[model samples]
Target chain A: MTADRPLRAGAGLKPEHHRHILESRPDIGWFEVHAENYMGAGGPPHFFLERARALYPISLHGVGLSIGSAGGMTPGHLARLKKVADRYDPFVVSEHLAWSTHEGVFLNDLLPLPYTEATLALVSRHVEEAQTVLGRPILIENPSTYLRFEGEEMAETDFLRALARRSGCGLLLDLNNVVVSAVNRSFDPLTYLDTFPVEHVGEVHLAGHAVLGDIEAPLLVDTHDRPVSPEVWGLYHRLITRLGPLPTLVEWDSNVPAWPILEAEVARADSVLRAAGEGRARAA
Target chain B: MLPLDATQQTFAHALLRPELQVPVAVAEMVGPTRERRFAVHRNNVKASLVATLAAKFPVIQRLVGEDFFEATALVFVERHPPRSPVLAEYGAAFPSFLGTFEPAVDLPYLVDVARLEWARHEAFHAADAASSSIGSLAALADDDLESVRLTLHPAATVVASAWPIVSIWTTNTLDAEVRRIGPDTPGEIALITRPDEEVFVHLLPQDADRLIAALADGAPLGEAAASVPDGFDLSTGLALLFSAGAVSGLLEGMSE
Candidate 1:
């Protein structure tokens, strides 16, 4: 078994910059790739991923596992994910708390689920199943919500805490999601984070959000384009200062900037991570 | 209050069908109205899939204007939502869908163009394998040539079209200039291969696909070469196949 390597901060791997990354060998913490993007049998994705794996620690973040599906998880997808996980042997493997599949169709978007006892039970069962198939404890991320359900019987943080405890899985705290959900749902972001089960967090994600609608009441969309916002950066500071450093990833999925621009984001995140680590060291 | 199963089924149904009302369970949030808020998920489901299709079929999008392509893609997305979570495999049915799309019917060759594009995509992601060279075939004894069955690389595929799709795909892709393809333009066969990890689209000679099809069917070299009509340019075909590294191996000991 490979020993777990430490990852401070990393950038999402983009196909356009794969060759550049291999050639330049940029000084970043690690690289995280969407598990779905590398699910292909063989090609440039695998070719570059293999080379990158040799250079840096890798993390597999899944976007379509649909672990919260009410209809239950697909065994085929779980098997395919296991194949990828075994082949890459990434330091961390994480998936969203949202479900993207309904009936038989994949919606290609992380649809939110109600925070209820039944929902928690379903997600925990699926998460356990995935963990068994993957042969490892996976991290479930807090989703970015646009609307709430009246059927919700519990708080989002309660649901996540219960999920992690029950399934023995870690949590991937996406700070941008916190800000987006807070703004959309009329809640304080910091208050929500205070109640979060930080001890269970294995990784962190920071990204930029798009603000839609009017200034009086803005709707934040988790569009991972552009750089991380100051608000999310502040939240990351709050989390890292308290939680110490984790494997933080700066995600820019669409409108992916050039390598230098993306590298700057990774660099900034690395600096924040280093400062937090030093602060924790001094306190100890 | 709706249960988890009912809530998901209702939300999912409303997400795909915009005409349907947002499920009653989705309460009014702080910022936007429930309809406006739920529209976010609606927009995300269709827009993201549309974006995936657009990325996969850029040449098709280029052929039809962006608006037309998006309109047609939205229809295709609704009609054939992806069955798998891998978005890369989402648009396998798009070529056939375009064939019947009334708005794109005027561009008769669009379907073939989409096919060539899809072939390139499949070749880009197909299983990686070592390719055989012409020397491998030459090394064999002349007596063994009849029994030698050439195996195409896993990434190799032949797309034969009645329209000049190769030129259409090329001009639109490499050169920014869009040339009008006349109805009288000659048909072409495109051979897509990713031999050394880079996908290349080559215009093959007429009826080259038949040789590829025969070889792909595990036919022996001599029989596959003979399957073509007179003046099949067997030497050139063999050279092209080997040079592109499309021939992965040569098999023998097969009974005819």
Candidate 2:
């Protein structure tokens, strides 16, 4: 179960806990950080992150590239992303399946895109361009969406599968997003996961999400402020069974607690990976 | 079956416009009354992005307070959603946006505050460089100081503003003494640098104008001092600069 498939279990590092994380250097496999947070050169963030980089495999997760927009990718954005990737040398890089910009102004949100032939071509090229600049493949994560485009020609799974197949990039399967999007969109979460092309998955993200209480609404929000929901955790366990111990992250970005609270979350993952070795997840 | 191009547009439109009752086939599995679930995704996208902007421009949020800031933030979001997924680089043009905003017109100084914040943000992430030693700088004779080109750290930022933005920003900032907060006077220049994680800002009217002019022309230490006269204490400034490691090196003055 642990055959060195690039596994890491970590929480998103916050400014409040930077010193604590670095000082403790807990037994976690790796730590994930937002690429934008490290865009600056001389600061405590950089200082600590660099020091920690010596010990942990860092992952750069981007939240702003509007890859889905028909308007095309920004050269400046790609150049900046490349520079940070070069500077940090993060072991893995990932971004949402959603789009965030249009005509230069950024909404700073992961907005949905119509999954069409044109979009497929646009997003695929963006991914290809990113890879070309980086000289390596990045993991394009499936997004948690609130609304569906009325005219989508391809299924979300098909679009992602096609993107991975064509661009040669890996997938960062966010199970909570899968569950959130599935429940919100009224698709079977298992069917979605089962139909998902798990072969290309390089990492998995397990984060908390709050369900918008509108039965009339078809959206499940990705809040990332609380503990991973039990249902989402169950999905994560299933993911490990299939993907076989992929790098898993537990992200708690808002109202983040002390290091000990986050460490407990990491501990759960450690046991999950440990159990996987014994072929216990299938039984559980 | 929806056309690939048509479906995408409609779907994106439906996703954004929650009021739309159109039951596109892709969401059919969501069954009737499925719009609520879809709203979750919309809420997430909105909430997260808003929070990002808030984090980046806390000073602006503070000036306007939470409610007004959030309302304006929403408008800003719809108009200028981030082009890149990188939140750090998301609000590059926010200062300009704040300038043209009608609601913010009464607070003319708001835009400049954004500019200063952006400058601090920019300086914080700017490339690091080694500072030149004071010993070598001391060797430069009186004649050489005026015409030589002085290398400044990439993180050096000089911002000139009409409002007491420095004080206003100071008062509003988490680091600033809250009771000292007051209005800004015009034509003030603020210097910002991040030799460390904590960004430092200094308000120097005469020194700022002279230094900014001199720095722009790539003036050496002596020349920069000449431009500022008694206004700039070159020795003191140089000491600060050397300690802060603001200089990469000093260039020999060809003009002298």
lDDT of 2 by residue, B1-256 (tens): 4544354455455544456655464454444354554554456556776787788788899989999888877777667765555566667778889888898899988888888888887877777766577787788787776666778877777778777778778877755457554453455677776665667777654464566568657766555677776746667776666565556777784554
Residue-level lDDT of model 2, residues A1-284, one tens digit each, is: 11333465776768888777778778878888887777655666678888888878778888766677666664477777778788878888887777665555554567676777777888899899888988888999998765566567888899999999999989999988888878766688988999898998888898888755556643467878888899888988887866566788898888897888888998898778677756855565
**Residue A113 CA error for candidate 1 (Å)?**
0.8
DockQ of each: 0.82, 0.38
Every model's TM-score on chain B: 0.97, 0.81
* lDDT of model 1, residue B155: 94
Residues A170-204 of candidate 1 have per-residue lDDT tens digits of: 99999999999999999899999999999998889
Every model's TM-score: 0.98, 0.83
Q: What is the lDDT of candidate 1?
A: 0.89
lDDT tens digits, residue span B204-231, model 1: 9998999999999988888888889999
The numbered model that scores best in TM-score is: 1
Which candidate number maximizes DockQ? 1
Model 1 Cα displacement at B117 (Å)?
0.7
Cα deviation at A21, candidate 1, in Å, is 1.2
Of all native A–B interface contacts, model 1 reproduces a fraction of: 0.85
